[model samples]
Target: MSTWLPASPCTPPGCATHDGPARHPLPAAALLLAGCALALTGALCTPIALLLGRDHRERLTRAWAYGVVRAFGVRVRVVGRPDAHRGGPGVLVVANHVSWLDIPLIAAVCPGRILAKSDIRHWPLLGPLAALGGTLFVERERLRALPATVYAIASALRSGARVVVFPEDSTWCGRGPGGRFRPAAFQAAIDAGAAVQPVRVRYFGAAARRRAAAGAAAFVGDDPLAASLWRVVRAAGLTAEIHVMEPIPASTVHGRRALAGLAQSTVASDRANLPAESVHH
Candidate 1:
């Protein structure tokens, strides 16, 4: 089954320009410290959450995630609310890949284990956090790991965990063509009998997001960890809009290509409303 709705208009705020070299702020460092503290707090509370049911554990996990993002001084603005019904047991959330920040942003909203590129496992502080958050790593080129990854995703879903996957596979500027949504993520949803919830991640009014994208592209041939995280946190505060599109059932969307289109269309329609921004002098 398919559904269509009118697109909402959106425009990112003007980018605040800075003179000379970008300097780090004490608050940013403090936020990092606070996140570490939250992680420790979560660790301490795990046993209690475990005593609760699976639902409680996931809720606590999400609360911990919210703390981390909040501690980072990131502002989350959810545009379209997630459907509570679709959010129930065994749903696969497929979101458009915008930035590395997408991970935590999704975690904030859906609060689930996600499949990330294997390279994320080697990242600095983020690597450890991702592991602790139960992220499943996948090798893009290795077909052998496909089965294991799929099985893991299925297990996560069956356990009432929402599994988030970025169909775009990589980040791109929201201005124009991002990239094609890889079919494997969608295929995994179909194979697992999970419903797909499309989310659009837009980092509005942040010069840092643009700079981060450029730095990431420049470091594509080298170590991205250092450049990536710095660029992400360089801004004063990042305002991200997570618009949840209507959910699509895998049982209804059988073909991988068709599912990919459905996911892209969901994102594209919402993105059409976002206000375009250009860096100023």
Candidate 2:
């Protein structure tokens, strides 16, 4: 189903003045140290979580994720609340992908199994932690593996585990909405009678001013993870905004394609209203 929402005005990239994050860098390398601590902590805690059961493991995962976000010194603000009923299993969260930081930020508010690329399972320090936390990794490059991935997501939902999916399939600069979300993941929610919640994530300066300064937070093209971490930790007063829109009942949604379209439109409309800063200033 097509949406009737008005589109956000877009100017040519160079034509638009990009207002970046305010000039405030941190004094020490706190995030890097925190990363080390979280990694070690997660590793030590993983086995304990497993024996505790899935619910306990998920709780521990959320705690670890929240600590990681705080360790980076990034502030997180939630605009809307996740439905109480949709808070855990029986709910599927769909969000716009901006940067690597999106994972930790999302975990703080809505914690569950996240559908991520397979590479994350091997990242230097964070990889094992993610695996231990019960993340479902997908080989996005392998088209044949999609059905298995979708089935995994469906199983998670059917078991009442909230699965967060990034429909865009890739990162965006957050200047506007990214590419259309692939509908394949939505099929999981449909098969399992779950509600799909759309989450919009964006970055801001300590002042919380809306602007294009997302580059300070975005992990796009050629930007390495180390560099992204440095940029984030060095930037003082950075806050990630999480806008939680109402969950769409998958029970009522007809097709996966239509479900994806509606979720995409919801995110795009919310993004258009965000306050942005002029980069040229």
Candidate 3:
């Protein structure tokens, strides 16, 4: 019943898994473009999504996202499950930020209303898609807006809406310990009496896990979106991994800072356990 399998060459850092289908640049590009086209064409589902109940809407969104992930030729493996949390207010999922793909990767496993940066609302095709997918956009850069954003997330939690938050506030190379988890979002869970779920996301080569995360996987620095997309598709045998840690009950947790520290430590510790990954204090 466990999604965990025998250790994959990719699962352990530095292990090379040189066994799989031959990958080429052109084919990867074509597949990626086709996948994007497919997602765009599927826009009709949005209006339908609006009419569906909460559970149904979440399922619909997950299926759509998984489809896109496969189109990009990215294999995703999710460990742990979300159903573990007792029925209550929705959960607040906090994860490390890696690349744009993190969104779909998370959605495919446990689709929810993702709390994203506000500007994403204006993105070209993605903007419309996000709207249909029910993204909660926040202007994170403005200190004054933090309260409003927190309040919105809390309200959503109270309404039983699962919200995915990347508390890093920025993307990292994902090679070392990721950025620190910002505690602001933790307040939402406390305010709404929702559980906090800490998740760790990692990327490895599909066949040769020994190689570093595909250039596409890390969105740090000033990399352009177009280039990152191409890098991901072109990099053959890319696989993504997500580990869902145990949920910490808000009622049991003392303060927002303590909650944030616990979740961050949990995530950091999980990453360190990846045999191939090492983290510094």
Q: Best candidate per TM-score, number?
A: 3
Compared with the true structure, model 1 gives a TM-score of: 0.72
Q: Deviation in angstroms for 95 in model 3?
A: 0.6
63-145, model 3: which lDDT tens digit per residue? 88888877887888889987643456999999987778898888888778899878888988778787777788887657778
Between candidates 1 and 3, the one scoring higher on TM-score is 3
Model 1 lDDT vs. the true structure? 0.63
**TM per candidate:** 0.72, 0.82, 0.84
lDDT of 1 by residue, 1-281 (tens): 01221121211222112222333766656766676677567755654665776566666666776766666556677876666643445788987665556766677678767888788899886676667657889877677777788777877776667788877665554555455777767777777777888887766545535433322212111235444444445555456668877888888975989998888887887554544443321
- Model 2, 1-281: lDDT tens per residue? 11421122322242122244433444437566886589578666766777887566667777887788778777777898787643444688999877888987888788778898899898996688778766899887777788999899988888888888888876766775566878988998888878899998888774444454466677765566776777677666678889889899887877999999999999888565655433222
What's the distance in Å from true for residue 86, model 2?
A: 7.8
**RMSD vs true structure, all candidates:** 7.9, 5.7, 7.7
Give the true-structure RMSD of model 1. 7.9
- Flag regions of model 2 displaced more than 4 Å: 1-26, 53-59, 85-89, 122-129, 206-209, 275-281
Each prediction's Cα lDDT score? 0.63, 0.74, 0.74
